[model samples]
Target: MNNPTRTIISRRSRPAKEPLSKDIIVKTALELLKSEGSSGLSMRKIAKALDTGPSSLYVYVTNHQELSAFVLDAGMESVVLSNEEGVSWEIRLYETLHSYLTVLMEFPGVAGLALNTIPIGPHSLALTEYILERLHEAGIHSTSAAWGLDLLMLYASSVAFEQASRAENGTTLQAISASYRSLNDKQYPMIASLQSELITSDGEERFRWGLEAILQGILQRQSKFGI
Candidate 1:
């Protein structure tokens, strides 16, 4: 058998010459994550990647959880949020969510971190504020907007995690399509009948459709609330 190609974040042979810092640690951790996934990340691995002792890492990050939190926030900072005026609230909200999901997809390991950690980073805070503000501006009720943001985050993170997990398992979505197509028609007539439509998306079509459906549902409810 041929050797599998190894893909790492950075091709450089040497670690960065900069002094040890939280930024450096977080960057190195991200690089490690790109190659190793969440399960492969640890203080020892990070320290080794940085050519430092594991104990020294404690000065920058208190523990694994804190380090993971930092990584999560760093990923959030990479998302570019456009707060341009005059854009429809629906468009702005959709763009913000798409940007957030794009960032998480780029750093799949961060999906794990996002789900497990609470982010207070400036970028994360800004995203939350932007979403709430846009929703309220759209005349969505305050309560609905708050819950809507939560629901959106949950959906985005879970989607990112599923994509990452499937990639790591060396599984293709075709497997899912095959399984659905093979289900017994007699036992699950509706699912079996709809299998073609259910499994036919070109990856992003379904995500976009789902996002629009969710936002439309929320907006319909907001209209009912008369807010």
Candidate 2:
């Protein structure tokens, strides 16, 4: 029954913490975002996760807004840009956008950041460049291509955000259907008549239809306006 001996551990034997850098900070922020959504992306939470003071993060990131942009772009690194030699520009563009939507849905917080933050990171630039190239191949150039790029990204981000919100709030299509069913047909004839069609397709089908519709609109506008 001798007294338990305490063993002293040398600090030098402990594993050294990884050096802080912009890349590490962005990566950590992305992890937090994935785990806890947008709320987890605060400077204090990130610093705590890294076992450092919140002020230490300032050396790498200018502010939370800038870090958000970095985190959004880092999340976009997974977007697959198809470069198949034989694929049509339309198909490639659709696939690229689908890939982008998939990435946003996977990282729901990133969708919110994409809507709010102006991404300037290399990955974001690459995605934009890829979309622009496809649009250029389709004879969409100058202002039309630029505007189309913005429209495409906005549509995808918005859809992702909407889905994320629904997921977080435990909303369902059935709930919407039930609410629509309760509407007064006399007061809302169109909505009452089209309720079935409105909720018919699954998300993937609706998303594809939206992408095609937007592409068609852009093409029509470019043709009519010659821009």
Candidate 2 lDDT at 152 equals 93
True lDDT of residue 218, candidate 2:
89
The models' CA-based lDDT, in order, is 0.80, 0.91
TM-score of each: 0.82, 0.94
What does each candidate score in C-alpha RMSD?
Answer: 8.3, 1.9
Which candidate ranks first by lDDT, i.e. highest? 2
> Top model by TM-score, which number?
2
TM-score of 1: 0.82
Give per-residue CA lDDT, model 1, range 1-227, as digits (tens): 66569655665876656899999999999888877888657998988888889999999888888888778888888776777788877777777777787788765688888788877777788888888888788778777888888887888788878777777787776898888878889999999888888767736777778778887888998888864
Give the C-alpha miss distance for residue 121 in model 2, angstroms: 1.1
Each model's backbone clash number: 0, 0
RMSD in Å for candidate 2, one decimal? 1.9
